[model samples]
Target: MTAWLSVIGIGEDGLDGLSSAARTLLGQAELIIGGERHLAMVPDDGRERLCWPRPLKAAIPEILARRGRRVAVLATGDPMCYGVGARLSRVVSADEMTIIPALSAFSLAAARMAWSLPDIETVTLHGRPAEMIIPCLYPGARILALTADGGTPGTVARILCEQGYPDSRMSVVEQMGGPAERRIDGIARDWPDGRAAELNTLAVECIAAPGTVAHPRLPGLPDDVFLHDGQLTKREVRAATLALLAPLPAQRLWDVGAGAGSIAIEWLRSHPNNKAVAIERAPERCALIARNAAALGAPLLEVVEGSAPQALAGLGAPDAVFIGGGIGAEGLVDTCWRALPPGGRLVANVVTVEGEKTVFECHQRLGGSLTRIAVCRGEAVGPYTGWKPLMPVTQWAAVKP
Candidate 1:
């Protein structure tokens, strides 16, 4: 006999988001887990309310040990999206849990803006760094971003301003799907002066000059857009790497040695609602990545401007990862591989002989796909009489088993 855990998604409007069945489940549960706001939303009956203190990971196992007890965990929006349900599921089997999903804030914000969600890219910054969204931004792309807090809107505006999109139109939707909902509209160059809602989302419309970079498919962006200092993958090579990684909707990507952030940016561009975190040590490079993402329309790109493998700490697990620059670092490949789930994918790109050997060794140990790529272009060498070979790229792609 086992206890059942009910994970419920509530909205800013409180109990109104719950379905009749969900409400019944909450009423019957003896032990309830939630934040103060969610706890206050439930009808104050005799049901024992447990406040979730900091360090939720430590508390899960202890609470689950109490077998045969009914439990209900509360969360905002869909618990599965950037919420607590996934974390709980890591420890508890799916058979022991029931999830009741409500309208996600991203969806609500899109509706309020009178925009079709399928057509707009959406990213979440809640409980994540702003740098995570950098690679997704593209020129003329519309985006719906779930901000971490009130300060997020200003941060987004500042980032967009730093990029070339100073005139980009932005709409901030606050307290979405609730009675107190409000919407504010402005340009990135001149964000309106007002306190933003703690619970809010942003809508950005990218303005790009014609005949620059071609628009890519929803999830896979062309590699020509990013500004890199010879550390980035060419457009053709980047597309190949992303194809092997196979990013899905809502999955998070951990991009190491982000370099101009080609792989990370493409992951977000592949799916409107996808997420990623790009890690880079160079401050100037990090700033460049941020500008590239915002200009492209991924205002949610989170840039972790610190050196790895030290900077890799504190980041939660990712669905997939791409290692572009740090393959030769000691234990870097092993650390990333260990962090992945059984089905998680890791793709690394290399050019130098040392990098190739490192990736090959990792492939033999980890078991995945290996390939070499050679690209050449015909430069105008005295009226286009000769072909110049671009540097070859060695790619090793693998899935954790």
Candidate 2:
């Protein structure tokens, strides 16, 4: 007997903000689940109450157990907007739950600031690194950040100042849609008044410093941004490899023999939903991979330290697999190929004759496109400018049937 799950969205005004039907629903609820703050607002209806368990996920079993009963979950604003509803939907069937949404905090904040929600970038610093906002800090950018607590404003100020966007405007709009609503405004560089409410949102208007270099959102960030030990894929090859890899939303990649993790980093940068795992053998290279991933705004990238194919054990299936190093490792191609489901992509790049032979054999067996990439840049050749060619790379790319 599966219980019906009703997710009711509430705002800072609590029960007053809900409709008559919503209030009646709460009054009739047999079991109520919500955060401590939201649960406090209920009119002492004497319903069985449960605070969301630590980790939230651990409590899913109990929640599921209450199925087919008058079970109701309370959330703030739109439950679907960076709220528990999104997480629950992934585990629960759509028919099992009914989501009753209220105006989201993002929308309320936008109304307060008179900023169009669609025109501004929306992010949540709630349980996220402030550094993750790196990709959004271009001059003249508008962002609305859902903050976790008071410290988020200071963290935002420091990150913006570091990136030369010190003069950026920050409005800490707290307790929106309630009698305690307040707005604190300041610039990022001089964010001196750190006073903030426990429940607040950070709205930003970026103003970069004169000399600040804004990193663009694209594959192949500048090679100098990474900490590598001469083992990284060059900017040219990395860009080309990423193009061939073709990252899509919700896709995962496995960067086999990930040297400096440039491929994985760029793949992640392509889209927020994109995921990747960097498999590297060298201890130093693994450390470098972590550094580049964090600095470049893809901290979620998984770095597996050990050589393949032994290191590749128990890896999540990937939508794409790239072999940038250790192309000569035995059983590497076969293992990667067997791991990929149909429609998955595989690309390998090699500079040596032996490595080229391995790719060729795979191409023959697997049926993909093979090409030799010969890249050259102008160099001063004995007082005369001429094309200086770097070592040509043979690339084999294929998609699984």
Choose the strongest candidate by lDDT: 2
Tens digits of per-residue lDDT for model 2, 1-401: 24388889999999989988777777778999999999998866666999998999987998888777888899989999999999889878888887889999899999999999999888887887776777777888999999889889998898888778899999999999999999999888889755588899989999978878878877767788888888778888888899989999889999998999999988987776788999999998999999888777787899999988889899889999999999888899999999998999999999999999999999999999999899898999998999989889899999999
Q: In model 2, which regions exceed 4 Å deviation? A: 1-3, 193-195, 380-384
Candidate 1 per-residue C-alpha lDDT over 1-401 given as tens digits, one digit per residue, 9 for 90 to 100: 34388899999888876899898888889888899878988777776778887877777875677546888999889999778888888888888888998988777877777888888777777776565444445687788888888988888777666555667788988888779888899988899756598888888887643444445554445555668787787877877888888988898899999988767777876665778899999988898888777656555668998877788888878888898887888888888888889889999989899998998898888888889899887778886567789889999999888
Evaluate model 2: give its TM-score.
0.95
lDDT of 2 at 107: 96
Span of ten consecutive residues with least summed lDDT in model 1:
209-218
Taken over the whole model, the C-alpha lDDT of each candidate is 0.80, 0.88
Off by over 4 Å in 1: 1-3, 43-47, 193-195, 209-375, 382-386, 391-401
